[model samples]
Target: MKHLTETDLRAWLAVIADPLATPATLLAWLEGPLKKFFPYQAVILGYGELTVGQVKTTHVLASGHDQVFLDYLPTAYETADRSSIKWWRTSRQPFFIDPENPPAYASAFEIDEIQRFGLGNVVAHGVLNIKANAGCYFSFSGVEGPLSDWHLEALKLMTPLLNDLLLAHFYLKSERSPLELDALTAQQRSIVRHLAAGMDDKTIGRTLNIAEKTVRNQLGKIYAQLGVHKRSKLIALLK
Candidate 1:
């Protein structure tokens, strides 16, 4: 791996710190300024399940790769014991694969299949929110040597920001609009709006001139109607 100069590190940090940076914009930075340090030929980011036989990319950004390969991921790519999924299950740490000596976890068939795509190295890390029964992944692929210690360190440094941005992306994608709030009654909608404003049930109840128990009951009904079990999930959906 190449060593990043102080300036390079600062630039990478700037990209990560950008409050308005979307996943696509971050991906563009990964492909450009940070390429020298990470050297990935392709990249992907999204949320889904691997253990339950469901893999989907709610958001994806890739370069120097075919779209067909990504399109096949939900079906064909995931069914196989892909390296990323296998690693994600066993450990929370990032994992990597190189053509020289692939990990024992990856099946020979999977290795051959990956190599056939002209990829020689790959690295992946996952952020699991078990309560949500879902997780997010960041995958980087290269056509040459394995990722180096610097690359791993860089990713580790950026992991927190990546997880935050990825979750925000997921929430943004799934957030319901005001029109979608029609599913709830006016009172329920008012409660939801208060929740969105970061009010607790007690505070909301007091403000709305209702008892806390009433607020709880209303929240239960709202949760049932929205198919969510927790206040946080409901807030994310409504946000």
Candidate 2:
């Protein structure tokens, strides 16, 4: 790793104090100035506590991710026995997962999940909460090549600020979003959950025991009520 330029250091610290920070802003920073030092082709972020898993509180950001992979990410990350978050907290070091050469801590299921998503060479670190449970965590996938010792060291500089940006407001799922979930009917709510879980209309229809046409029609109504025009936007809000 090279020395952090004055520009890079400034860019890194400047974001934590950004009063108008949002996930879009954070993504810009990550894909922009931050990438110069900490390189990754794709990244996933989780905003919540440790020792517990819930899709509602998870926020994942990955490039070119399909719906099924997005739905799988949070569950795979929260694997208590083998997650990088659990490994890092317990070992006080950054954790690494390589698909072809799995680490001792990497579970078979975890590796399979990563491979299934087509993400290679995962490296993870986090900014834990008061009790060192969890505040936010991140995994940088498809790293250009080997992640060096210096790369892990670089994470020490950035994780907290990234966590700050994440917890403050990462995206639609942010606590700040004014979701009118109460506006939904019970069936609509179920559909929304299924959608967030990466179910397509046909699958949702099967699950709800409704015709595919009805699922599409109800989705139209749900979209109108929620002010989202597409499945991706709707999932972003609820996932």
Candidate 3:
């Protein structure tokens, strides 16, 4: 199949816009959309939960041919990029895997695992942090190279919808009912919201029309209020 045009992508997304669309339908639509946008032998969507020092995989969706790849996932995969996509749930920035430009923190063996899992030529993108400490991952793969801009944009266009779906997924599966935070002030809530949406301090400040230093000060207060020491922790809290 040919790659999707912007118009075609928009239409495809619109067809699945029903808020109550079943999970099976969502997965079915996504499989066709992903294959149309990028070349890959198979695709899978994995889900998990994160504790302070542990990550637990709860669910996984794979096209029929790709089930064997899950054998490579283990607790050691919790480092960052390999963590069954749970890292993206708490990250404010988009995590990308280009294979050609793997991040510096990635090790030789980690890279090997990616290749072995049939993910070496894949470019994965994270959507947003949602209920029950979950996020959605959009991954595109090819036979021998990284994704092109067209491919990225096609997936990017689905991010907003993807974020909503993740929240719904968590809300359906979670049992303990997420803890509601009472420490945030109104301004702090606004700040946290912007930060959670992947805005930097400067961007948050500009959007809120405050000084960047003021944004930092607010973030410091927020961190203290939420009992977090860093942005990552703060993100996890917000989720």
Candidate 4:
């Protein structure tokens, strides 16, 4: 990798510092300008509500790859991506995988499936906002060689702004009132509020003077009413 020039550094800073930049715009910068320095065949930015132990909703914010590859991500790819799951649960650091060093967290079957895509090398970062129960994954793939120190440094510089943009998108979505909330009863609404506040079911139950099972049952109904399947989605919907 080439050393980053002062002009290049300033340009990067300018793009990320733009408060009004959208996810698409930031990704465009990555795919275009940034690529000149650290070339990659494809980049994928996945964002949406995520729950511990599972991925609830996955939106491909950006992709410079084949549609078939993009389509597979939400279902087959995600189901088999143990490294991402582990990263979400245990670590915030960026991780890399390549033909030489496949992800240990993945099963042999999973590795085989991924290898079929021919994405040579990959570096992924998990962006999380615990308060909103939302997170994202930014992945750069299809490079020829191992990522250099400068490449890692560039990624570190971009992380905060990417995270802020994702969280902003979440907040914007949350500002709109979903009509589904009207279907919830008073007690159910209370549970939804507690969920948004990042309280666990047990804590909510204690606060509401209800049994834990009752809280769970109420949450189930709330989920049905809101057409959501996980606590994270529920929080996203009502938060």
Q: For each candidate, what is the lDDT? A: 0.70, 0.71, 0.60, 0.69
Q: Among these predicted structures, which one has the highest TM-score?
A: 1
Ten residues in sequence with the least summed lDDT for candidate 1:
75-84
- Poorly placed runs, candidate 4 (over 4 Å): 1-11, 14-24, 75-81, 106-110, 167-239
Residues 1-239 of candidate 3: C-alpha lDDT, one tens digit per residue:
23567687676566555443454356565556545534565555555555664556555555634546656545234545455344444453344455667765445665676677656555466553445654455554443354446555555655666656654655564422224345567777889889989999999999999999999999998777666799997776555
TM-scores, all models, native as reference: 0.61, 0.59, 0.50, 0.58
lDDT of 1 at 14: 77
Model 2 TM-score?
Answer: 0.59
lDDT of 3 at 71: 65
1-239 in candidate 2: lDDT tens per residue?
A: 55556776676566444553456566776776667556787877776654464223445555545667776544434446455545676786777788998888888878987888888888888766657554677788887665566567667777766777776555533542346878789999899889888899999999999999999999999989988898888776664
Clashing pairs in 4: none
CA displacement after TM-score superposition, residue 221 of candidate 4 (Å): 28
Clashing pairs in 3: none
Q: Candidate 4 vs. truth: CA RMSD?
A: 7.7
- 1 or 3: which has the higher lDDT? 1
- Which stretches of candidate 3 lie above 4 Å from their native place? 1-22, 75-77, 80-95, 100-105, 127-132, 143-146, 163-239
